[model samples]
Target: APDSGGGSSEDSFTEDSSTDVATEDASTLIPPPQLGLYGTLNQLQVDVSRLPRPDEYNPAMSSVEDFQTIDIPSDIKTVAYYLQAAQILPPGEDEIRFSRQEDQLAGGLVRRELDRSIARYAAESGDTATLTMTGEVLAPEVTSLEFYYFDGLAWVTQWDSEMLKGLPQAVRVVITIRPARSANRPEMIGLTNSMTAIEQGDLVYSLVVQLPLAEPPETMGDSAMEAMGL
Candidate 1:
């Protein structure tokens, strides 16, 4: 790690060799994601234009400035940026190729955001959930990123959109983050997430995201909207 690289961070990530990765016995030697230092969270500045262009949406508005700065919570730990993808036309020629449309096949009306919970369900099945969850506490870059659904009744830690045929009115995203140990760490290693629950620092952050009503078009079938609880 660089001498100036030290902030609040965990140990330096290793450049894993093919031989080392292939050896099961050597895997335990590597430590899970851990917090390095504890300090105030710094403000973040974002460049609007430099961000990746979304699949949809028009660039109707022109930027007066290139970048914008914003203040963040000083006690915060980490941040995870996510994008939900949808396209009118998916890859390749449209028809005769097994219905490769995101809306028709995935059915945004019936399975909003492709039932993001399926991946979580798979991860949290049986004893495996123990492996993924940091359990009673959250650790920087170590705890499982959890989503809680606030159904009309109460907030639930889990949801199956496929089984329910739709999604909740709102969602609560909870997770922790660790700062990059080195400047190049992000490009080289990406954000490190633990496969197993880490018992270390307890740092968590949550934000409530109220979902827009998934209103179907007038021509859309009544069955789907009803299933969606709209």
Candidate 2:
């Protein structure tokens, strides 16, 4: 019989080799690790531009010099600005009697300039109801932008003229969004929404946004308006 003192050299060697193979196989079975710092910092880029043109009926107007300003991150998923008929005082001779001259007389003047453009855009895709943006929000270097509506109770959602048919809510709202700034991190900015639910006819706005990251957003200045001769 073989010596019973201890295990053979060949047997020990085999056992060690088995353990090493099992360790390597086990490591291979594990999934790849998730992205960490690199994922956290890098982001996709997007641009947003959804404001009414200067020569249009901007019911959101509060005063002669008052214009809506929407701030967005250079990297933005979406942005929306809303204007409602309720923002304007009640329509009637009496309402006008108490309103400022510059505000009262300018309504039809602005609508005339925008009526055709609004109609054309609405008819472009064989859709009904219409919302058109007159100002440029994207810089010359950027392309690819999307539009949406600013709902009082929800995040931005896809919008079309058909979705607004026959309702005549007289609530005119516009929104814009871009892709995420990075794989995981989205840019964020403030959305200013001012409208009246019912009476008082005063503008009420809220500013809150979460999106992908990018350059700081800025307002479309008077120069942009003058360029269009608004």
Candidate 3:
């Protein structure tokens, strides 16, 4: 009488065994690795020591010393004084401008023709003029990366072959002022100066890097437990 239903007991044991096996299988599965993008900008210190000094000279003046006695008109003289002032401005003050976004950036430099102004003043006493400015920009980006600059009229293509990721990059921008072609007819040139009256151009740059998502320690612990069938 006690064994009459023994078959049912065996079936119950089989079902229980199957349920345990399913639980063990679920515990052993590993999770997939996660991936993501990380973006950052690092400010880089610029050393102007290595930059070449403004070398353009006025053919009308024998030497920079002549600038002291030049009989420049009052208006032209004013421009000359301001041009010299631009040079002593604070770092990243009147000389450079920077713009940044999530995936794009831009920089500009302001250049003034100090040499031309001084030279012109030395040549003429009744002439009024403004200094000419041209920008020579040099910025770095990841290799095969493309960027653009406002060319007074529109954005122009700026591309480079330097690739950068997950690390800071340094870009050196050099701005120079050269003589204007016509005397007493100086026109505004180069990047517009936002911080000063001096004509400006830009060579702005920064380092950008991509970083992997940080994996939590608990995630690894759980993965290991599952792998060990714990």
lDDT of each: 0.28, 0.22, 0.21
How far off is residue 161 in model 1, in Å?
2.4
Clashing pairs in 1: 8-37, 9-36, 9-37, 10-36, 78-177
Kindly report which residue stretches of model 2 are placed more than 4 angstroms away from their true locations once superposed.
1-114, 117-138, 160-230
User: Which ranges of candidate 1 are over 4 A from the true structure?
Assistant: 1-142, 178-200, 214-230
User: TM-score per candidate, in order?
Assistant: 0.26, 0.17, 0.15
lDDT of 3 by residue, 1-230 (tens): 11221122221111211111000011111111121111111111111112223432332542222222332222221111011112122355422221112121122221112223443443354322111222112221111111122212222222111221111121212122323336754333322211111122222122212112222232345544343222
Whichever of 1 and 2 has more lDDT, that candidate is 1
In the order shown, the candidates' Cα RMSDs to the true structure are: 20.9, 30.1, 30.3
lDDT minimum window of 10 residues, candidate 2: 35-44
Find the number of clashing residue pairs for candidate 2: 17
Candidate 1, backbone clash total: 5
Residue runs of model 3 more than 4 Å from their true location after superposition:
1-167, 174-176, 187-230
Displacement of residue 116 (Cα, Å) in model 2 is 2.7
Native-structure RMSD, model 1: 20.9
User: Would you give me the overall lDDT of model 1?
Assistant: 0.28
